[model samples]
Target: MTLSEELLMAYDRQLRTDAETPSAIGIERLGPLRLVTFAGGRGFVTYQDLAGASARTISHWVAEALAFYRSDPAIARVEWKTRGHDHAPGLHGALLDNGFEPDETESIMIGPAHSLNVQVQLPPGVSLRRVSAERDIRAMSAMQDEVFGVDASDGNADAILRRVAREDGMELWVAEHEGAIVSAGRLEPVPDTDFAGIWGGATRAEWRGQGIYRALTAARARAALALGKTLIHSDSTEYSRPILERYGLRRVSTTTPYRWRR
Candidate 1:
């Protein structure tokens, strides 16, 4: 197998379970699925594979998993993360039949952390730093929500605060211009593994085309390397995929999130 293929295999083997939900408040098992509950009334579903189940059996598992999440009144939203390389026959039909709407597909990019650690010139009057203060985090979250075209909500910021309190090796980084946050992303170093994920990367519309986001990614990559993480991974949208690709992160596969709202 090629190096990218080998790395993708390692990623599937090492980072597919609770490692994907390090901040989950609760987890339950249903066949090969891991039903996870996080802080903010969010439910998530993921697994390494289907264990060679038939299409009919997989459909049943889907219905059962949806029922499991639906039973919880606290769950406002559930996302089933499906990988492109998995043998999930009838999975798409099953999800749509059960009211789960598929979101945009993202590239699963992975590569050496050091490759992303190159220097990037920030725009004039812009600076990057690690944020921890509640006020700072809230600002960063709000900016990200706006950049992503989502309604401003405190739920994400609150959940992030809880994770911060746990000290789980998750780092929040941001780029600021004259005291206003223009870009932000997170670095989560997975425990007992060589991988750290770069997630929630967002930059304001006006900030696009500049190197601010790339610089922010590099800062996070450097931080991950400092924490002994050799591999960097991300489920990157079209906006960020090319940037990561430019940094030598190979797109090993695709991941699409199917969502159900309560």
Candidate 2:
């Protein structure tokens, strides 16, 4: 197999299961789909593959999945996560027919942890550290929401706090300038796997291209290595995909999330 195919297989085998939802409160299966309910009134759908279902079957599954989530009053919104490499014919039309709007596509990046462990020189007066306190987590979450153009909400912070309480080996790293957070990300070491995920990476507009985000990523990579994870993975936006590619991570596939709001 090609290098990209090899990496994609590793990701599919190691991450397409419950490892994808470490903090999920509940999970139900519909065929090959995992219907996951998280703590923030959010629902998510994922699976290893579609099993080559015909378009009609996929449409039926989509409608049924919506009904299942709708049965739960607590589910405020749902996202059906799709991967570009899957044999999911007509999945997009099926999603839209059920009122799901597609979000931006992201690169599924994967590579050796050590490739991202290089030293990076931060801009003057900037510092990096791991944060666990509520106040720090909130600040970091707010900064990320702002960077991503999402409205401010407690859902992300609350979810992070819950994960912190679990002590599940997820570390939050941030870059600071003058005591204010400028860039941040999370490192989650997948149990019984050779992978650690660097997720939710964000940097303030003015702070971009200063190597602070790179430094933050390097810090997470070091932590992942220390925790015995040999691989790093991320679902990266266009902003961060190029940087990760420069550090030797391959874009093995793409993921696009389709959302339904109640």
Q: Which predicted model would earn the best lDDT?
A: 2
lDDT digits (tens) for residues 70-187 of candidate 2: 9999999999999999998899999999999999999999999999999998899999999999999999999999999999889889989999999999999999999999999999
Sequence-dependent TM-score of model 1: 0.99
Q: Report lDDT (CA) for all predictions.
A: 0.94, 0.95
Q: What is the C-alpha lDDT profile of model 1 across 10-93, one tens digit per residue?
A: 899889968888998999999888989988889999999999988899999989998988898989999999999999989999
Looking at model 1, the pairs that clash are none
Which residue ranges in model 1 land beyond 4 Å of their true spot?
none
Per-model TM-score, in order, reads 0.99, 0.99
Residue pairs with colliding backbones in model 2 are none
Against the correct fold, how does model 2 do in TM-score?
A: 0.99
